[model samples]
Target: MPASIVEEFWRTQFATEPYRGGGFALTANPTLEEDRRAMLLVAADGTETAVVSPALAGVTATDAASFRAASAEAGARLHDPDLVHYLAADDRIGEETGHDIRLLTSADEDAFAAFEAGASEQDLDDAYVELDHWAVVGAFDGDELVCAASAYPWDDTQLADLGVLTLESHRGRGIARRVVRALAGEIIARGYEPQYRCQVDNAASIALARRAGFEVYGTWEPVSPDQ
Candidate 1:
């Protein structure tokens, strides 16, 4: 698919990443917060573009230059800077380790609540409650939830972005991989492509995506206000 089409889908459906060729295409959305608005696009031919809305653009004279500087500073603060990876599903060859994986719904509130109780971070819980295009699959060991994966609509087209979480006690096992595979399978069966995104420094997540047959195609990093 052309990168332009992908950009359109992301912009219209997800209200983000409004990329057009080597430039940015602005779209009006009253709900977008000025401080949280920014876009970064790295094209296949090595061309790149970074855009900030008019409200935030004045903070820096050049969006691309400011974004690059921010990314460099972020990298110095940590082992790796924040990055968004574009991934596509390829093949599925991992064994299904017999963990029961089930889709979550409003009826699964109790199970979700239990899973939330063990959550190490808040993003999953916040997305679960707020996103309308969200879908979740949880992996269970006997009666306990060990890991879960969730996908949210990525664009107006057939694309979904996914995240996975495995309880601290279950890190080494393949539960994360299994849950992601199951979630990706469902997303594909529903006629959408699954996109796996994670921080570049998250080795466990990167390995899980690879184990589940996803390959990285592109990377993006945004400029934060503090930077």
Candidate 2:
């Protein structure tokens, strides 16, 4: 897809102004959070747009003055802040290891339960309730699910947003990476681009995305009302 098309898709999805490449654009209705009320998009060159949804309208710093004013506002805070990474199907690197990785379905409730133990409540809901829209994959250590990954279709587009989680005990064992590779491969086979999103402070997730050959493309900072 063209860069312009990608930008338009995001802008429309968030109900924001047409992205003009650089600087910041503000929108009243952020698609991710119904209660966020306002959003800000920052782009380095103009092709990649980073989303920042503050609880209030004038919160995020577009320039300097707005930022300070936002900071002074009462009950202002950041939420769901993350960096977005895009990976082309052809650019995906890594081999599927011998680990027992398989597609997850509702029948695999036990495995799903184990996987959910490592994921956030919101993610668990997205993975299960919307199971039809996601390609779920799980890695098992014997009978125990050590890691899980899901590729969510992005707004009916040919793009898949990848989310992965691993049991605490399975950290550093490359299980997450393996599961991601398998899931990404499946996504590619289905004719879609895979995207990896990581929180700005999540060092492990960042490292894993890089190792999996996903290049940093953009960033998103979405704030919620409760914050």
Candidate 1 per-residue lDDT, tens place, 81-118, comes to: 33344434235434355678877777766766677677
TM-score result, candidate 2: 0.66
**Residue 11 lDDT in candidate 1:** 61
List runs of model 2 lying over 4 Å from the truth: 1-8, 11-37, 43-80, 88-95, 115-133
lDDT of 1: 0.59
lDDT by residue for model 2 over 120-222, one digit each (tens)? 7864553232334479888888888777888788758877888887767778888777788888788878877777877778788899987776766565544
Give the best candidate by TM-score.
2
Candidate 2: Cα lDDT at 60: 54
Alpha-carbon lDDT of model 2? 0.63
- What are the runs in model 1 whose C-alpha is more than 4 Å off? 1-38, 43-47, 51-82, 86-97, 122-133, 155-157, 223-227
